[model samples]
Target: MKLSRDIMRFFIIPVVLLVGIIVTAAFTVFYTTTARTSSGKIISSNWPKEFTHDFSEYINIMNGTPTISDTGKNLLVKNDLWIQILDATGKEVCNYDKPSTVSDTYQPYELLNLYQYGVGQYSVFVSSVNAGDTAYSYLIGFPLSISKVVTYVDTDRYNSGKTLIIMIIILTILLILALTVFYNVVISKSYERIRESLGSIASRTYKPVAGHRFLREIYEGLDTLNHDIALADRQREKDTKAREEWLANITHDLKTPLAPIRGYAELLSETNTDIPFERSRKYGAIILKNTLYAEQLVNDLKLTYQLQSNMLPLKKETLNVTRFVKEVVIDILNAPDLEGRNVSFISNSEAATYFFDPLLFRRAVTNIVVNALAHNDTSTEVSISLDADSGVKLTIADNGNGMTPQELDDLFTRYFRGTSTEIKAEGSGLGMAIAKQIVEAHDGVICAESMQGVGTTITIVLP
Candidate 1:
């Protein structure tokens, strides 16, 4: 399994982005929900504890003098904190910005309530200072949120549970890190297999990516690409093989007729021998026929190329459908060699006008009709039918040896002739292909149906 840089980056980038987003969101929630602004600085959940005790260092009495420094007093006013200094009797001695709600003296029970809950909405903290063995108490109050919660614990119990809590938290973090590593490993392995499968596409050797629930979409797209490429490759090979065969056939066909023409002309050109007139005439006719056969083959090749390249100009006009079809069939069957053929023409109406290029259309019709007769014996009756209902429809059907399923499928493709056919004449192997193109050029549809030994039918539908 190969894991290229691109695949690794593709997988890593998204995971990295996800982790970043989670971390950023966690910090955002912590700050936005729990943080408060104090004196141009952001203070967190412990703001109350820090604010109350931070003034203690500036509150020491010196040499029987009670003192609160200027810096400590500024901190109290800025944070809206109040300070009250009390002697041993619980009577206020000195105060700074003290609240009106606070009385001049506090009793024992009031002191307990003040220490635990503070005055009104304020939460308070206490600090002690001493000078010359005189101990003075200071109370600092801060007005903030609605709740004042303090935990009172015995020293032994607190110390005993602290180690267990630390161990539990450490184990939980370790478990989380292990699961993260395991998840990444599995994801990396899956991407490696997918990378290998993608690489196989270049060599046309595909591997199925199955049982990957998370990578279902990727695998499905790969499967479709493989299938379409395989189909296209097969079609290209088939066309190439067919084209090669047709080239071989064309060479053989052109040479076959040239041999007889050259041989007969050489015989008639002999100067020493006096040839019989009638025999010479026969040789001349033989030469002419072969020459015409070669000419027809060349013409078919030229027309096929012209149609394929869309270079053939179409001259369309309205023509009487029933009359045009009847004349075409009669003209084809009027050939001397086709004298014994049995045929019939059928039509639902006398006349209908359809617009099409007659010259190209005639070639298309002649090719289809001759195709039916050439493959069948003279005794196998043929019928030509036309209808003006809905649109124009023409059908040429014959009861002959017919064709197999494979032949029917490939009828309009470039196949020289089927193995089952008895050849009286051969074409350039592009007859049906040309006919289909002509019909399609006129924006019409041509299709064929055949059953083995039952007969064959070719249908043409025009818009």
Candidate 2:
């Protein structure tokens, strides 16, 4: 994993600052140590070097070689550095503006001590020279204070200020360039990656982004959003297809009853036919029955929609669940269509009261029981049982033609009829769906367990 840009910045900025400090220090040291070598002589603004070089000139004079000129002597005197030359016997042979504190006669050992200790208000240096059989010593002294060293450098190269300004400009440019490169590589590139990912998302062809710690989090979020969008698209397509299928099914169901009603009415309205009174009444009853079937189908559609939209008003009341289940089962068993069917209701508990909408609950229970009776052979047996384990539970089990796993999966979906050969042509295919909606509105769960050629069991749990 790559590091975050902010963390990299946190690490790089201090390193850059330290490097800048070191570079500035190195530059200062470089120019401060700069010297001009000329005439086999090194000249610098350093005071220590000036004192040492002045002492070296005296060695030539003490050796009788006399290399120092009068100009050099005056230069040393002008800087307040006194000079002395002593012969082999330790007698002072020459002196250049020597101070009153200086000894005229000095022993070699005594001068050596002074040079080593620098004992007086002045700092001193002593050197010895040999000329054939003769030997001589040179002594030099200057003020002991070291403050003059900085003053010397300031008076020389740094006095012009040009080098300092140029160094500052160069360092500023380098620092700016360093920061720009860091920003472009670490920060700007990450932003570019984000923009590219967004573009891919807009085109619905997004790929997961490889990124650093923080950017990785962002990429994960984008992936999640992309997944959700894809799911929503799929759901939209499924809903569209379902709506089309529902329209087709509803059209067919409506026309099935409407066609018969129209034929019978047309037959009765034919004045040319001398219809018997009994035939005319039969025709009237047929039209009324077909009309009622159509009206019920329409009402089922309206109720399903209202329940789905949470617009179905409920008249809730407290009632015994056991009694309610038994009554609903009895009513279903007494229906003309279920006249010869085997249906029974059983309950472990005699009475368990609960608050619920009796009308809606009756409809829900009726839908399930009717479904079991309608979609099975005449010999199929259905048993409705009630119990209260965790909550009020109702089980409707039938030894019917059963259903495939796929059919059971969509059994409660709107307009999804089972593939069982026993499926009725008169069904609107909304019964199970309406039942499911009603149960959920009561804050309950309903599920089915089924096996092909075995049976189907629907369990409803109410809380």
Candidate 3:
């Protein structure tokens, strides 16, 4: 049986009823047996004497009848009594027959009390009485049936049993109802907590209760469900912001190159015979540069997507770190846009060998240096250094208009621009985010320390 049902039936009411039944049954059986035994003993002891005295009284009332036949006739007149006269030698003297035609055989000097005879439930007693001095005795017989006593006792017991059974059933039902009501109240309170949790989650204001306790699996399950719903809600918010930033970044990057491309194309379309060849060549070169820049931006966007989606394949190689950094710095210094900027490298490690994907690692480092140059004032100097302790540490520092604490906190977020920078710049603002992603992919950490009006330092730690 279920726990609730068993508690209601057995624990609550059946205990009382079981005890009542056992006690009542014992008492009924004891009373019935005791009554029957006492009735038999009484009839055995007194019935014979009672019948003999009644016969003698009858003889006296008849004025001392002289003959045994006269005594028998007078005894027979009182049909309620059974009487027999016997001789002194235990021989039958006279037997009186009743109107029912039943024969009575008299015996002499036979001692009898109420004796049970035949298969019937009755007590029979026989007594010998001295009637005259002629050596004759009268034997009187009496019968008392215990069946009536037993019938009455049994009827009472049966009625009592029925009443007890009914009481047990009624009490059991009442207990069950009471327990059911209590259980419903308790369980409903538990369900109310669950309903409140659900309502909060539906309203997007979900908060978890601290130190909650649960007795059932359902309560624990509800707690877990609420937690998951809250987490998903936060994730949805993050995804919405990321999507908006991505669209804005893409539009800004595309527009930067498109403006110059469209301007050069319009100039080329006008049929002006006085157009100088050098100016024409310069405009054509600008168009080509912007076209390639736009193409590079599209490819970088594709690569970023592939990396995030787990579709980018890595080509690992062992490279000398010192030689790699020196070559990259020299290449950056030779760029047309970086001609006026002072770039320098300081390395303490000679033969620092590391294993990495060269293309990805180079991209990450170049993006950082490019971002520094773009943000720094023209008069400021950019410095790059490599130092090793347990592993390699790369530092890129620029003396530029630095960032505040708030800007530093959100530095690597996509499409987030520093307050001091023009929002119309060609930068997509994904560079630092991509750099951080690549650094983490190589099992490294990237951090920045900046002070307003001082400078910003970007540090990369690789292990």
Each model's backbone clash number:
0, 0, 4
Task: Give the per-residue lDDT digits (tens) of candidate 3, residues 1-463.
Answer: 2344533453445446656776898778666544223224423333344555555544321233323456556545543444555555555455554223323342322233223341123333444444355534554443334332213457778888998988997897677667756765555555566667778878867666555554466656766887887788776776577658767877877888899999888988898756788998999999998899888877777766776776877787888887888888887778998876888898887788888888888888888888788777678788999986457799999888888897897777765555445544555566787788788778899999999888889999999
Comparison by lDDT, 2 against 3, better one: 2
Global lDDT of each candidate: 0.81, 0.77, 0.67
Q: How far out, in Å, is residue 27 in model 2?
A: 28
Q: Candidate 1: lDDT over CA atoms?
A: 0.81
TM-score of every prediction relative to native: 0.65, 0.59, 0.55
Better of 1 and 2 by lDDT: 1
**Pairs with steric clashes in candidate 3:** 84-139, 90-108, 114-124, 115-124
Rank list by TM-score: 1, 2, 3
Q: What TM-score quantifies how close candidate 1 is to the native fold?
A: 0.65
Give the per-residue lDDT digits (tens) of candidate 2, residues 7-74.
Answer: 56655776687679769999788657643332334334465545665455544544364345676677
163: Cα error in model 3, Å:
20
Top-TM-score candidate index: 1
The superposed Cα distance between candidate 2 and the true structure at residue 204, in angstroms, equals 3.7
- Compare candidates 1 and 3 on TM-score and give the better one: 1
Please, what are the lDDT tens digits per residue for candidate 1 over residues 227-330? 88889898889778878888888899999999999999999888987899999999999999999999998888888888889999999999887888888888
Candidate 3: list runs displaced more than 4 Å.
1-188, 207-239, 266-276, 419-424
